[model samples]
Target: MIAAVRVRGRTGVKKGIQDTMSMLKLTRINHLVLLHEDPTYKGMLVKAKDYITWGEIDEETITQIITKRGKLSGNVNVTEEYIKENTDFSSIEELAKAVVAGEATVEDAGIKPVFRLHPPRKGYEATKQSFKEGGSLGNRGNINELVAKMI
Candidate 1:
């Protein structure tokens, strides 16, 4: 899956990109959405790259995120029993593993796909430029380290 975090606020942004970001569910700064890496989502990411940072995430980070930040419908906390009752998996760890392994998706498990995270502990390196330019926007390859900091 892809982990996308909105890095910038909605100031001086075009309406088109704003719509794209909203469609990706990145409506606020520091909001994270776990999306499947499909071509349509890829195109949308490119369109909203100026406002967010996205990348491939691994199993460990996914587990930590689910355990710490995941919630169910109506703002309920995710628990081992919840996972067992709502999904085939018996635990959150297993659900996270399936998600990272591409065997299941956030939607499939009935968890809210959005992960509202605090800003990274020390903040982003820079938000004005792309990741390749030493900033925090755009595709960041494997972003497990960054995700950990946010978690």
Candidate 2:
């Protein structure tokens, strides 16, 4: 799965970009969404590249995010028991693996689709520039480090 994090706020953003970010479910800074790496999602990522950072995520990082930040309805934390009771997975690790493999989704695992992450521990770099330019925006290649800091 591809992980996308909104790094910038909505101030002075174009309405069309805001709408695209909304469609991606990245409505706030530090919010995260896992999406399939398909053409449609890729297009949306490109469209909102100026305000968000995205990259391929691994199973280990995904598991950590789910364990630490994944939430259920009514603000409950996700646990192995919850996964067993509400979904086919026996553990969060398994669910994360399934998600990374495109065999399952956060919703299918009974977790909220959006992950409300803490801002990175040390804060972001230049939010107005791309990752290639040593800033926090645009595709990040491997997003594990950034996600780790936030988690």
- Best-performing candidate as measured by lDDT: 2
lDDT tens string, model 1, 9-64? 98999999999999999999989998888999999999998899999998778888
Worst 10-residue lDDT window, candidate 1? 77-86
**Worst 10-residue lDDT window, candidate 2:** 79-88
Give one clash count per candidate, in the order shown: 0, 0
- lDDT of model 1 at position 111: 86
At residue 58, what lDDT does model 1 achieve?
82
**The candidate that achieves the highest TM-score relative to the unseen native structure:** 2
In candidate 1, which residue pairs clash? none
